[model samples]
Each structure stands twice: as structure tokens, then as C-alpha cells.
Target: MFKYDLKKTLSEKVFIFWSMIFPLALMSCFYWAFGGIYDIENSIDTRSVGVIYESDNEFATYFGDVLEQIASEEDAILSVSEVTDKAELYGLLEQSKIDGVYLVKEDSIEVLMNPKYSATDSMILKAFGNFYVREYDMIEDAVTSGNIGAVATILDGMNEDADYMSKEEGIFAQAPNPYLWYFYSTLVMGILFQAMSGIYIVEQLQADLGVRKVAMRTSVSPVPKSRLIVSVYLSRLLVALGISAVTIILMNRLFKVPVGNRLPQLILLVVAANMFAISMGEMFGLFFKGSMSSRSGKGTGVIMASVFLSGEMIATLPGVFERYAPIVNDINPATVLNFALYRLVYYEDLTTFYIEIAKIVLVTVVFLVIATMKLRRQKYASL
Candidate 1:
């Protein structure tokens, strides 16, 4: 029965296009449109800046020393150039020699930028100035209050070698890529498309729905209804996973998307996702009174809406929901699956991943229980 169901599923042309070909094609379009932009936007290089000293106060000297130390680091973000006067600084800025200039006053510093300076360079310079001023104010307050211990603590905290945060390595050492969101969401949409198969499973088993002939034959067959349903469900799930595996391989190899090396966890998430999607289809089929095509169309609409809300089309939608309506993300199945896949691959957050898996499992069980009860109680009248 499983083999027969598998063969039947593989032979569906609509399933082949919707689940396999369409996703790959969409991925190709996304790659061509946004791939180069992400690469250029994410790249960060050292920036050049000029520093002019108009005052020789203690704070000015200390600030200069801080800049010198930061510029000397192996992976320094700034290359510092010392200017003798404002004339030389303005000269460099006009000539495009330095991206920005820092003017060191008596107790504070000012940032002057070239008209053509990149936004990234301007932001870095401004941020450094703001941070320095804030830290200096804290130290000044400590000294004025005669808090000797606080002064010492502030100085110790300012040490360049002080470690406040540690980086935890995930399965991949690659930096985060925002563009992967589209690809992952596309993969999710493809998986959800498998819900059509679940609808078909209902069409075959329930005597009152779908094609009258096939439904009646399956309903009266000698095979136990529970056993038959399990066989069909497993077969459809295998097909979904098979397609997902191929999608992952293509995403990693062909498109250069980093799906990470955590194969075991990834497989587990996709399995749960497929089960949830299929069970959702089962619920739709059992509850909605309609022909198979009508039910399939409604399922597709719901899935598309869920995907859109999960940021499949607009990348910022999920973020908006996260900040304003977080519960939308928690309950939306597509969002849950997308978050699970993202956490699994980029964050390597197994705790969140397992939580998402539990949600999927819980929903799947509820859907299956309702669907099973409905199928079991189905009665047909003899003519």
C-alpha cells in the first residue's frame, strides 16, 4: 500500500511543478535579483580618518592615546591620520584622502565628514565619537563625586583587552546573510505545498468526499482504515522529505546558500514540518465540504497567506510582527518553521528549534486525532 501510494504521489504533475520546479525557479530569480546587493552591502572595510588636536588637555591626550591604540590593532576598523591644523584636515577631506576627520577639543571631540563619504564610514565615525563622549562623561562624574573606586572600575572597564561578551560559534563560521531568509522561506513554501497530498489522502479514504468511485472502493476495502491511513501518510511524508533534501542540496551547492552542517537537526525539523503540513491538509479536507480541487485551492490560499505573513514576500514582515505582535509569529506555522530552520542553521539554537518541533508535533497530533475520528465515524447509505 505504501509503495502504491508513493508511486501515485510521484506521478502527479501538479505536485512535481508546485513542490519542486517552482521553488527552484523562484530561487534562481531571487539569486539574480538580490544576490550581488547583499554581498556589497554586507562587506565592511577599514576606513581612513584624520585627527586634529586643538587642545593639549589631559582628556584630549587620553582620547588621542585611545585612538592610536585602536588604530594599531591587527584587525583595526580605522586607519588614523594625524593633521597638524584644520587647513590640512579640510585639504584631505576635499581631496578624498580621508573619509572623515575628528577634531579633538578641550573636553570633547567633533566629527567632520567629506561630502562624498559613504554612509557606512560616516556612521562608524559618528558612533565612535558618541561612545567616547558617553564614556568620558561617566568618568568625569565619578571623579567629581570623589568616587575613587568607581573611577578605578571605569578605567578598568575601558581597557581594550577587557572581555564583556563572548562569541559562540555555530555549525558554520560564515557571517550572517540576510538574503538567506528568502531562500529559507521559499523552501518552507515548497514543503507546505505538500499539504495537497494530505488533502488527496483524505479524498481517497473518506467515502463521502472526493471522487465517488475511488472513495467508495477504498472505504469498503478489506484493509483496516487506520493501517491504510498510516501507510498513505508515511508514503506522502517520504516524498515530501525527498523533495526537501534535494532543495537543500541545490540551495547549498548551486546557489551558495549556507545551510550549515547540522544535518541531524535539520532532518528532524523538516520531518516535523512535513507532518504538520500534511495534518493541516487532512483537517482542511475533513472539515471543509467540497470537491478535492476546491479543497486544494483553499489549502493553497491559506498556505500562501501564512507564508506571506512569515515574510516570504516582504522580508521585514516577520520583524514587524516580532516587535509588535509576537504571538502571530508563535502561532503561524510557516513562521514557526522558518524560525526553526533559521535557528537551526545560523544560530545553532537547539532549544528554540526543539520548542518549534514540539509545537509542530502538538498541532499534528490534534489534526490527526480529529481527522481519524471523522474518518472512522463516516457512514454511507445503501441504495
Candidate 2:
């Protein structure tokens, strides 16, 4: 029965088109449109600093030259521009064009920073301030080593083991994995929609198109319902898989966004999450049976639940609602999926990773079993 059903679905061109072609098309369009749009650029750190020191006085001349040298260096992250007067810096501050400003007077440096600026942005002011004071650190180190060429060797070593540097030294890597919070949110949403496609596919076959044919005995005898559903589900599964593959590829190629886990582990999690979503969708369709005639509103309910639980609204939703509401992020499948992915990447401990993956797989399996059972019990009249 299973083979016959499978063979029947394999022959259907539309199933292949929907499950593979259409989904690939959507994936391509989505990744292209939004791939570069999503990234973890600490543009906060890109904040430019205004230097209002004059280039005339001896101290000012030396300090200003040192500031430009540091800012121009590739390793130094800040962008600097000279300001003729304090009033100019103050005016730009009001406009918020730059994050902060500095006045390098003879006695001490005065920093005017926006209160709303992030800690890391403020670090630019502090770091450069120290560099302005300790301009001879590099010269001293070079002289102590008795070799000017040794600075390159020192820098090369720093680049290799930058993370292991002492607490005083900071490590700069690609902005932490951009996908940590919202990656799973997007993944879960995509999974749900893909599964819903299968549910609709089933309806198209039996409820909408097959209704009259099934009532006709001559037409009904040649076709088995199980074979039809399986065929459609297989097609939808391909589509679901295609969407996932394309997203991963786009993230890697375009954004260079790190997903943390090995490629294989990520694929496994994506497939597992998709399976659960497909199963839940199957149950919804089976329970409702016919959307055109039944008008059960179950499909609408599914979308509504997902919207609330997807974490997009979690911030606006009150704490009480988030805690107790069934559709809140804490209880939503999207949140759970994202949490698992985050742990897999961020948490170095394997035990926590395994626990989260197990939870998601458990939920998925339960949904799949229940959905299959529900569909098996459905009553379809002969055409």
C-alpha cells in the first residue's frame, strides 16, 4: 500500500513543482531580498569622534598628530575628524551625527559623550584617550626589544591568539553570531508555513477536487486515499527542505553569518523542526478536513497562535501575558526552537545542547504520531 501510494505521488508533476520548484523560487527570492539586510554590524562602534584640539601649540601639535596616526591605523576602529571650536562639536552633538566628542586641552582631556550611547561606543573615547596619553607604548616596546621589525612579529602573534589575550586586551571577532535570537524565530516560521502547504495540498486532493470524483464509484476504485496523502506530503517535505537549504547557503555566502553549530548539526535540527511542524499542520488539516465547506477557522487559529508565539510581539506583550499566556514566547514552538539553537551555538556544554534538542524532538514526535492517527480515523465518502 505504501509503495503504491508513493509511486502514485511520484508521477504527479504538480507535486514536484510545489514541493521543490515553488519553494526554491521563494527561497531564492527571500534570501536575495533580505540576506544582506540581516547582519550584526556594531555600527555603534563605528561612531566617529570629534577632536577639537588646535594643531598650533607644541603639545596640541604632537597630540593631534598622534590622534590622526592612531585613527588612520587599520587596527584602530575609530573614525576621527578635527573640530575647529568647541561650539562646532557641541552643535554636531546636538545633531547626533557623531557618538561623542573630545577636547584635548593642555592639562586634561574632556570627553562629551551622548548619554544614550552604548558602553562599547563609549569605549572608543576611553581607548583613544589612553592611547593619546601613552603614545610611547609602541616606541618603548620597540626600543626594549632593540628591533623595529619585531613589531610586525608581535602584531602577527596578537592576531593569531587574540581571544586568549589578557583581560586588559580586547578581542575583535565578527560580531557575535547574528542568528542567535531571531534565526530560530525565522526558521520556525518557515517550517510551519511549509507544513501548512502539505495540509493545503491534502485538501486540494480530497476535499476540493476529489469530492465529486470520490462520489463516483468508477473514479474512486482506481485511487487510494493513503497513497494520495503520502504523495502530497512527500512533495511538501521537499519544499520544506529546499527552503532551509537555501537560507543556510545564503547566510554563509552573503552575510558570513555564523550559526555556531557544524553544518551537519544545523541541518539535522532544521529537518527535525520541520518534521514536527509538518505533523502539527497535518493534524490541523485532518481535524478541519475541508476548509472550503467546514469553515472551522482552525487555519486562522494556527496563524494567530504563531504570530503571538513567534517572539516578534514578545517585547510589547506584558510580562504577565508572556508568563501565563499559552501563545506567549515562553510557550511557543518558535521560541523553543530558537532557544535550542541558541544553546547549541552559545553554550559550550554538550549536555545542555542535547537536552534542548531532545525537548524539540519529543514535541515533534508527539505531534507527528497524533496527526497520523487523526488522519487515519477520518471518514471520507466515496465519490
Best-fitting candidate, measured by lDDT?
A: 1
Writing each residue's lDDT as its tens digit, candidate 1 over 94-160 gives 9998878888898778889886654335545765776676678898899999998998988786664
**Residue-by-residue lDDT tens digits, candidate 2, 233-268:** 666565667666776565545544446645677777
Number of clashing pairs per prediction, in order: 0, 5
The regions of model 1 sitting more than 4 angstroms off are 40-177, 381-383
Worst 10 residues of 1 by lDDT: 163-172
Cα deviation of 168, candidate 2, in Å: 25
TM-score of each: 0.67, 0.50
Runs of candidate 2 with Cα error greater than 4 angstroms are 1-39, 43-184, 204-230, 251-257, 289-297, 313-330, 377-383
- C-alpha lDDT of candidate 1 relative to the true structure: 0.77
RMSD of 2: 10.7
**Cα lDDT listed for each candidate:** 0.77, 0.54
lDDT score, residue 252, model 2? 48
